[model samples]
Target: MPLPKPPVRRARNKEDNELLIKGMTCALIGAVVLLAPYLAKSASVQDLMRQAYLVGWFALILGCAFLGRYALRRLAAHRSAPRG
Candidate 1:
């Protein structure tokens, strides 16, 4: 048997704006997490470069955790919204 296609619904302006805001916030947070260590440092060019490299991985892990928590919160909020 073949699977059926799901129907598509257009979003209202408010919904679109909400999604846009969420996307922007996520991007901003991702950028900040990726830049945090360099933003914290006072060092020579070589040391900064080294720090940058190490911080990339550190920030990636941190960002993953942050994003996970963010998504989990959103999911919980979604579940709680209409039933209350």
Candidate 2:
């Protein structure tokens, strides 16, 4: 049998970066939600959902913050690449 071709990589660009950040945020939040029931619940489903919402919000905010930092570092590296 012939070898299969590797999957094609998407172009790395601003739009892609935005998408990546959004995807990561969603994945992390979803993971938190899936585990919410297993976690400690105060009184009812309302409380549990409230906690989940707060946690999810923070997770996304932190993810975006780190993504922005990474972008800045990449920009700096690119600028300093040709040190002559």
Candidate 3:
């Protein structure tokens, strides 16, 4: 009897999926920023700005973390590649 084959993984498709997720994350962040003011009642302008800044910082950090990792990987790949 023949053994079952393992699943094949594609690198390009995984990269595309990561990009789509990053874009969607940005979109959701934008929507949240736009809706923040109207969503909070009895909140002062100062409070709203503080909340927005915190939210924005969190998103920025998360996105940058992934981007930094991706950039580091590409840099390492280039460093290892032979130059003509």
Clashes of each: 0, 0, 0
Ranking by lDDT: 3, 2, 1
Taking the tens digit of each residue's C-alpha lDDT, what string does model 2 give over 50-79?
A: 567766666767666656766775686579
What 10-residue stretch in candidate 3 is worst by lDDT? 4-13
- Give all TM-scores, in the order shown: 0.38, 0.44, 0.46
TM-score of 2: 0.44
Go through the candidates in order and give each one's C-alpha lDDT.
Answer: 0.56, 0.64, 0.64
Candidate 1 wrongly placed segments (more than 4 Å): 1-51
Query: What order do candidates take by TM-score, descending?
Result: 3, 2, 1
Residue-level lDDT for 58 in candidate 2: 69
**Candidate 3 lDDT by residue in tens digits, 1-84:** 966754544684487458557855865685566566777675795477556766766775666666666667667757966575
**lDDT at position 41, candidate 1:** 57
lDDT of 1 by residue, 7-84 (tens): 443453345446545655655655665565566555665465555554555555555565566566567757855442
